[model samples]
Target: MAKIEDQRIVIDCTCEVQLQQTIIDAVYLALKLEKEICFFGNYLNTSEKEHLQQRTAFYANFVKKDIPSLPVSVLLLEGKLNKLVKELGEKYNTILYCYSGAMDNRLLEAFYRSGFPFYFSKKQVSNSNQFSKILIPVDFRNSSKDSALWGSYLGRFCNAEIKLLVANEKNTEDQDLVASNTESISRLFNQFSFPWSSVLGNSSSWGIHKEAVKNEEPFDLIIFAGSLNVTLVDKITGTFEKRLVNLSEKSVLLINPQRELYLICS
Candidate 1:
């Protein structure tokens, strides 16, 4: 089994229809990764804290009923959402956030600035307890390695099959870099004895994610290495990470390329 430094998965609880499914998805991942679970919510006042606690308790109990052996904690945090998230990121390597079908700019910003990888999901759990197939879109950037590392971890620990979507760049230098990345990623997967396949994408680096999300092949999750720098256009519209997280129907595992990530050890 692969071991992580923290070995804890934090689930951000909300009062949305996606709440129950989020818990289920988190439990599934926690069990697979052999990590403890924490259900977290933010509250402003005493009344709100009580209400959030009740909501978290109800769902935590539901999860406990089925998986009695799992270690679970429920916490009501008091602070700005971004500050709270940054604090949590310091203690935990992974955080799970479920979208309520509506875009929450504050929540997205919190996750973006936290400098940690986050699992973003919707109302429905696509793979349920088994994340059998994972799609990773790879480009020439060094950050692509982080996403590949995550894929290898899941592939080794959760028995997931990795599918790499390679970006097709027109520039010779970029294309050469892309080839090198593909070779390196393939080598990593081979070293771990995990099953992975690669397919060339017919889009630019920024647009390959769209192709991956819209691909005909069924995938349980899409792992993306996001850029930290935001341009003026990105602000007016949204960053590529935000757009991918919002538009993807399948769950997305978003990794901050700028952060030094902790790898799973054998």
Candidate 2:
């Protein structure tokens, strides 16, 4: 992670009042990383744009009082948000979108296929962006290693505790490898001085989500790795990835396997 301070973040500045919370959360992420924040300012007309500008400025000030150091910019969508995002995704390292649960599926597909690691969340972020506990669901795959590294980076950055949850069926063929992978992940996190632990369980994403919902202590963030879907078999029966995203309430950091993991900066 080469001091990843220069980040380009694109967020939809829709005029919906409900979206305001998510927008502020997104800005908080940018502030955490001191990254450049970009907004699609064309989503609103003159009066609405003025109101939104005020709101955005307020959030920016709330996060960082030093206005000169905060690199915030607005781009006109011109009714071509999808196309503009495709271009931006190619040029940027990190992209954060305010997912209001009603975005077009096609647009999301574009984000997935854009080859950039992106963040999506419907819930408001914590007032303090210091993630106390971070969870990474591990499977016996190369992408899981990538995800673990990311979790370690974030854990160190936030001075947080990291945990890797290994979920698998009892009858799975690679049970031994799963155990080995857990040990490997533990060692990796330990190198980063991240207090780490492991949880072994056989459950689906829905079950994990249910437990998190009921637990007194919930994870602040869940990190996931993107699948290539290279093989025909893997394409047909995708893992619990999508379900994990839909069923969880915490923030998600999705890593695109196609791109170099080093590009996934804070």
Residue-by-residue lDDT tens digits, candidate 1, 1-266: 22453456777776555766667777887777677678778877888888888878987787788788897777778976777776665565444444344445776667666555778766554544446889999888888888898888789878888999999999999999889988998889998866889999999787888898888248888998876677789888877787777888877888877667655433
lDDT of 1: 0.75
Full-model lDDT, candidate 2: 0.59
Q: Per-prediction TM-score, please? A: 0.89, 0.70
Go through the candidates in order and give the C-alpha RMSD of each one to the true structure: 2.7, 5.0
| Top model number, TM-score | 1
Q: Model 2 — which ten-residue stretch has the worst lDDT?
A: 207-216
C-alpha local distance difference test of each model? 0.75, 0.59
Once superposed on the true structure, which residue ranges of model 1 sit more than 4 Å away at CA? 1-6, 92-103, 123-129
